[model samples]
Target: MRAQIGDRLVLEGTHLGDARRVGIVIAVAHDDGSPPYEVRWLDTGRATLIFPGPEARIESQPPVADVSGPA
Candidate 1:
């Protein structure tokens, strides 16, 4: 999955259930955009940072400063 910055990532609720979290992609690393992402997410308030896999489904827009581009 070619997840670009500014995209959103929903912590697969179908799998994680209540524990599921969701947030938007803030920053990318390696300048190559590889697995083990370094995302700045907002789990419904509390700002959280994680390094999920590339296969992690992206939302492209959740709730945060869109890192995609443009205003």
Candidate 2:
């Protein structure tokens, strides 16, 4: 699967447990938006990241980032 930044990777009621987190795509993997993405999520005020495999289906896709905001 391919997804831009700000995509929410929810494991849902799958085997990964009922873990729910929302993180921004701080960084991309390759030139193309594929798997193994480094997602910086907010967990209890901590930013967690992981290189999830592309095989994992995305539950939802968030809107692309807006540079209009303060950088």
Candidate 3:
């Protein structure tokens, strides 16, 4: 899957009773928006680079203050 910076990543738990992890994509390593994203987790407020697994889902949002658009 492809994602941009500011996108939310939700990683599903592998087994029952496991809690899902949620993080926001802070940096996109590739220009094509591939894996190996830098994410700041919601729980710990720490950042890490991650290659998403099969259970990962991307939640995209609009860019804050589109600079080129009319005010």
Candidate 4:
């Protein structure tokens, strides 16, 4: 999987009743947007480098709408 900074990393639970973990990609290790991202978890507010497993997926940031009036 590939990701950019500000993208969210979602790790789905592997077993029943397991909680999902979500984090923001604070840093990318590779220029091509590969794994080994530095993530700051939303739940615990802790940062760590992680090589995401199969259960992990990247959630790209939505495009920001233009609040300014149309030209």
lDDT of each: 0.61, 0.59, 0.95, 0.97
Clashes of each: 2, 0, 0, 0
Tens digit of per-residue lDDT, candidate 1, span 1-71:
54567776766544534566667666665466654455665745544556665435776555567788986
At residue 47, what lDDT does model 3 achieve?
98
lDDT of 3 at 37: 98
RMSD of 4: 2.1
- How far residue 13's Cα lies from its native spot in candidate 4, in Å, is 0.7
Residue 40 in model 1: shift from native, Å?
3.4
> Residue 16 of model 3: what lDDT?
98
TM-score quality measure for candidate 4: 0.86
Clash pairs detected, candidate 3: none
Q: Judged by lDDT against the true structure, how good is candidate 4?
A: 0.97
Cα lDDT of model 2 by residue, 1-71, tens digit: 76567676553334465665556565667768776666666665444556665334454554568879887
Off by over 4 Å in 3: 65-71
Best by lDDT: 4
lDDT of predicted model 1: 0.61
